[model samples]
Target: MLSDMTATTLDVPAELPFLQSLSWFDAHWRELTPYQMLQRYERGWRHRGVTADLSHEEAAFLRGLIQRFGSAIDVPA
Candidate 1:
């Protein structure tokens, strides 16, 4: 059924290095709080030359991440 599957387009606000976005709690990721990481995430999304679309299972997983902490990501005035 591989040929019958349709690809879905996902808009990930930010793209992490080597798909590091999935490792939200890794020690390196822990270095920055969710708020801090979210800030950098927004910035990266803004200037990222590569497209931020993930049309696969990871896309669904990352969307969950955004939904989980998106409300808390804020930039200072």
Candidate 2:
């Protein structure tokens, strides 16, 4: 029974088309500047606990965006 329960991961593609459709800052925290994205993410993390609404890839993308563009803005975690 245990042997039959092996976990399998799906290779889902990134939501590039969905992203492309959205305008800049589509949502309140959608695709604003990297610093703003980081700021909103960090604020959400602070108030609501962990990233319940975000997927692992989305969270990682936010971090990468900050590192790539908002490295100088030091928002405390």
Candidate 3:
């Protein structure tokens, strides 16, 4: 006999405080998954409507994460 399996793993931050604070997350409530939240946070999609008050380290972390994730996406020149 044989068995079939399917699984996926994502490298999400252990403590995503900023993501937890988003109203969209609160409003949409159950629709957003951990991976979707991580993707949105990395792409700066949450920053569009509001001004972010990030510290130097936070800004740098976001930039690094975006660079790592957004490498697959094309950017306009």
Best by TM-score: 2
Q: What's the true lDDT of residue 16 in model 2?
A: 25
Q: For model 1, what is the alpha-carbon lDDT of residue 48?
A: 37
Candidate 3 minimal-lDDT segment of 10 residues: 1-10
Off by over 4 Å in 3: 1-17, 23-37, 42-52, 71-77
By TM-score, is 1 or 2 better? 2
Cα TM-score of candidate 1: 0.34
Clashing pairs in 3: none
Clashes of 3: 0
Residue 65 lDDT in candidate 3: 49
| Per-candidate TM-score against the hidden true structure | 0.34, 0.39, 0.35
* RMSD, every candidate, angstroms: 12.7, 14.2, 7.8
lDDT of 2: 0.42
lDDT of 1 by residue, 20-72 (tens): 54344565763544444444555555433354433355345445445555644
